[model samples]
Target chain A: MEKKQRKQSPQRPAFLKVLQKSGLSFLAMAPLLLGVIGLVGLFQVLVTPKMLTSLFQGNSLLDTLIGTMSGAIAAGNPIVSYLIGGELLEQGISLYAVSAFILSWVTLGFIQLPAEVEVFGGRFTLYRNILSFVFTMLIAVLTTLSLQGLS
Target chain B: MKKQDKPFAFRGKYLLLTVLILYGVIFLVSSQSVQLALLKSGTILVKILPIFGVVILFTSLLNFFIRPKQIAKHLGQDSGTKGWLWALAAGVISHGPMYAWYSLLEDLRSHGMKDELIVVFFASRAIKIPLLPMMIGYFGLTFTILLSFYILLGALLQGLCMQLLQTKKM
Candidate 1:
């Protein structure tokens, strides 16, 4: 009976060891996964026409630029993307600017940058970001013109 | 003596079998859409098998050829802005979903990389070299040029802002 009990105990520890290693990997991936799911849920809730209309009531190019910047500031949550995309389209915001805004809102999260800084070093991180920003605007302008041609 | 190993292996197989059976039962209780999604994901993976293989092979190459320590040595504190520039170029050529690249970023960070460079890595996803031909075909050369310039410029601005505003955080 003692031998049998000893065997049973070893089984538990062996199983537990496997569980522990896999568990840590899962934990590391959990935050980003949850963030994505939460963003999707948020996208379904707040992406409405009226909200965007109120957000971008003005016509100035500068206003559009500001709008994009604000979008970046509020970044994360795809719901914002849908809402802003709709509003920008309705408000006659240039496709170039709107595209840039959408891209930045997702790709460039200024609010999240601090968190990123905590993970990546400030200098290398900053230089990489500047390059990304440049690319974002470039894509936006190009997308805008192409969209114009289609229309 | 070799035969004794069979009992231990059998027990391992039994445990795996038990877990799989339990998973199937739980999956049955889940929504039908969840099942459909799994099926759909499998189908998509099959369709993209070649791309998937190439990407996986590339990822392995990155792991083998570009050790994080090497990247660190070039982009580490003493290496300065020049190191950062090369880091961005390397980031551009790399592939996979954002989440997949996190570990690599973690590796770089541990090797003394800055956060601003990490942000640049995230930002450079906009420039897909493989898709450039398609984009040019659809958007025209002028629009493509302007868009590429804008993205690069915006990324540069973002990096500078973060560097100036939060250098010590990382």
Candidate 2:
């Protein structure tokens, strides 16, 4: 009976130990977390659509490139991406431009590089983002072409 | 054990200082944006913290209850197709900011998750099931479907590319 009781009690300490370690790890990571949040917050202010829309002038192809650059600078939730993508389309931005912006907005993370590097490593973060950035443009152009073809 | 050999990878102080300086410059240019930035920060923290806390707790519980060897066995190198599905599902369902998911991802990486799989998970996040209807409404069904397929294809390509390009340093 005492042996069973002892066994059950050990499980609780095991969980406690895990909790303690996680708490410490969270503390250790707090600085990085705060830094990411701060940077993203600052980006939120500076990247208002009014300020960003003007940068996307020129031909549709040029707009596509500019849109990719804008999206690569920061990221947001999918709903936000969709809403912005929709609004841009309504505002006379070509589907090519808006689509690239949304694509990179969801996929790329130049600003999140520090946090990603902390987790994955510098090479992976840097290279993967570059690939995602390139792919965003590729897919956006392909998407626009395909849609046009269908129409 | 290998994790200890390296110092903490994130130098948050430097990053924090960099952003603060940028904030100051932005403040000089537009005090309104600065105020907007702070307000945005507060709501973001409120919205993100709970989801972030829950993921951390889940990972902690997982770390305690499950051995690393078990994790490596299932989600590691040998996980294969099942692993891909697991990653894809997690990505599609994940919520909040991408950064909120970072710490949990780091935990998975330490437990021997492959780098390619990590890329798959990140890439797959572009697919949000809940938002599909809204997307279809805006872009039309055919365009939406094709785009979603492209996003998934892009994820697979990204993962495979990472696997091929990355050296032993990973």
Q: Give the 10-residue window scoring lowest on summed lDDT in candidate 2 chain B.
A: B1-10
What tens digits encode model 1's per-residue C-alpha lDDT throughout A119-147?
A: 44475556555655655665665656655
Give the C-alpha interface root-mean-square deviation per candidate: 11.7, 2.6
Over B1-170, each residue of candidate 1 has an lDDT whose tens digit, in order, gives 12121122111233334434543664677545345434543443344345434544443444455555666677666667786676667556755434335544664565567656666566655556665665555445666566666665555556566676665554
Cα lDDT tens digits, model 2, B63-111, are 8877777778767989888887788778878876677777778888888
User: What would the DockQ be for model 1?
Assistant: 0.10
Mind giving the per-residue lDDT tens digits that candidate 2 earns over A1-151?
9999997775444777777666666666777777777777788776776666777675788989888888777544567777777777777888888889888887886777887887678888877887787778878888888888988
What's the distance in Å from true for residue B108, model 2?
A: 1.1
lDDT of 2 at B71: 78
Instruction: Calculate DockQ per candidate and list them.
Output: 0.10, 0.53
The parts of candidate 2 lying over 4 Å away from their true place are: A1-13, A149-151, B1-11, B167-170
